[model samples]
Target: MARRQVNPRDLDLVIAAVHAVDPCPADQEAAWTDRVRERAVSLYVLGDTVGQDIARLDAAKQFTATLLDVRVEASSTRGVLVLRNTSGSSSSSSGPTAAIPRPGGR
Candidate 1:
């Protein structure tokens, strides 16, 4: 496959554009791909951020919006997507998040 480019507002497109591989290799029908279908309210927090992992999981059950602007650092305006290491430490943190404006502008 060739390189692909996308914007935050158009991230939902990846759900359909993803290909199949591994244990649940169903391409667009994969379970992993299904989770992020509603990118606007997807919950993804730092895996090494103590209770945040479980908190994020619980919030997912109710379709809440968290991890909206996980930054690279305290002073950064950019966002990040974090991953865990073999020992449950923060291995990497990159990428951005997608979320539509909240209702009532709150």
Candidate 2:
């Protein structure tokens, strides 16, 4: 193959940009794990909190809004953490309600 000329300036710029954004692997990995865990907890807690709010609502719209939020969280299967809700109404369990993680959740 014929030798190709390289742009030293462009290469140096790329190197500088990469160095500017360098992250400690261990620290970043830990941070990412923590964020994922936090998001999972937030999603779970959001459903429960909305359900609690719905319990106190008499208007259909208010109750429906909260219910919708809960339903979305209950049904979410995408992402690293999957939350499966079981309830007589949810079709997952023949009971009032339960939130269970999918297999291999941890």
Candidate 3:
């Protein structure tokens, strides 16, 4: 059970990249990026190989892009986070939508 070491600078780069592509507000972007980084660290600690954790981070980036696209395209007032089923039976287009409460109840 060796611990995987991830460079903090690398994590910062990933967060910056996601924020650049994300349409969410600055506050939301910071929060989501932190959450994504935490998840990647958790995965790495839970026996995921370094490559697996990197892939997971990549998927998180993709998720951010998809969520932003969906929200903009849907013209949603409430923040919408799209959840994709990873099971082989579901396609990305058929994923479920979760409404996120926007800041200041907007």
Local distance difference test scores for all models? 0.43, 0.46, 0.51
Tens digits of lDDT, candidate 3, 1-106: 9999989866665565555454556668778766666655565455447778778767763422323233422444444444334442322232223455445555
Order of candidate numbers by TM-score, starting with the best: 2, 3, 1
lDDT of 3: 0.51
Q: 49-105, model 1: which lDDT tens digit per residue?
A: 646766876776342233323434434444354444445555334533422333344
Candidate 2 lDDT over 1-106, as tens digits, reads 9998878754554444444443536748776555555555555576588988787564533211112222213354332222333332321222233344445663
Query: Using Cα atoms with residue i matched to residue i, what is each candidate's TM-score against the true structure?
Result: 0.17, 0.27, 0.22
On TM-score, the leading prediction is: 2
TM-score of 3: 0.22
Of 1 and 3, the candidate ahead on TM-score is: 3
Segments in model 3 whose C-alpha atoms lie over 4 Å from true places: 1-27, 48-106
User: Which model is ahead, 1 or 2, in terms of lDDT?
Assistant: 2
